[model samples]
Target: MFRSMLVAVDGSDIGQKALEQGLAVARAMEIPVHVVHVIQTAAYPALALSDLPPPDIAQQALLDALYREAEEILAGAERTAAAAGVPVTTHKQLGHPGAEIIALARKVGAGLIVVGSHGKGKLGRLFLGSTSSYVVDHATSTVMVVRCEPGAS
Candidate 1:
């Protein structure tokens, strides 16, 4: 039985499905749910690439932007969970997606961690190694994954 649940959301339809799935479980258990979104710096695309080394300021700025994006994703998840009558908290993390998710799970003392099979990015999860798959294989806590077919909206 899960007393606290951690839902890792990334704004993809699959991620939305995972959020809904986690929300249902948390509501059934009448326990708190924590929604997390991570914008991994490595996952982010470089901007204005040039022969000249990019300024450290530019790299930091890009990271800042990614964190903002992460916040928006978590905010949307928070609103969705609240509307569904589930008490939820949101967090934004930066790092490898899998590592950040597992770290957040531990931080929240969540007994369960949930994630989607694929993200909304151009690179398919098979290539990037689905965050859900990684978490399920590596996380210390229990994990639940909701998979959506490729090309699903």
Candidate 2:
């Protein structure tokens, strides 16, 4: 008894797999699929510079690049959903990815949220932080975490 499915994608192989799986479920349930890509932005300590450009300018440039990348990722996901004959809507958000995904799921009234895990071990997750873990823990809706195998789609 799901109304809508939301898939959070970040252009990774695992993310694509999650999208595919989410689409399949949505199709079977005859529900709409909404795909979201989040561009994570964080404040960085100012770099010590001798007569260099302003840090704000550098940060803005980096943010621009991230937005462009987010568009490309969303476009690819849109194409995949279209090819599967599944009508889909997409959203691009700027914030912590896990938080943004959960926010969108709630905003869209999604019955399920599908995301991909990078399969990083405990040590790796400790260093890199885990978006899937955050989503699984914080999301109000049901979450499906797709684990990506090495060299497999």
Task: Pick the lDDT winner.
Answer: 2
lDDT per residue as tens, model 2, 1-153 = 889989999998899999999999999999999999987753223332324476587767876787799899999999999999999999998777899999999999998999999888689779888899999999889999999988564
Worst 10 residues of 2 by lDDT: 42-51
lDDT of each: 0.82, 0.88
lDDT (Cα, tens digit) per residue for candidate 1, span 15-114: 8999999999888899899888877656555532444365488687876777777878888888889899998888887668899999888988999998
Candidate RMSDs in Å, in order, are 4.6, 4.5
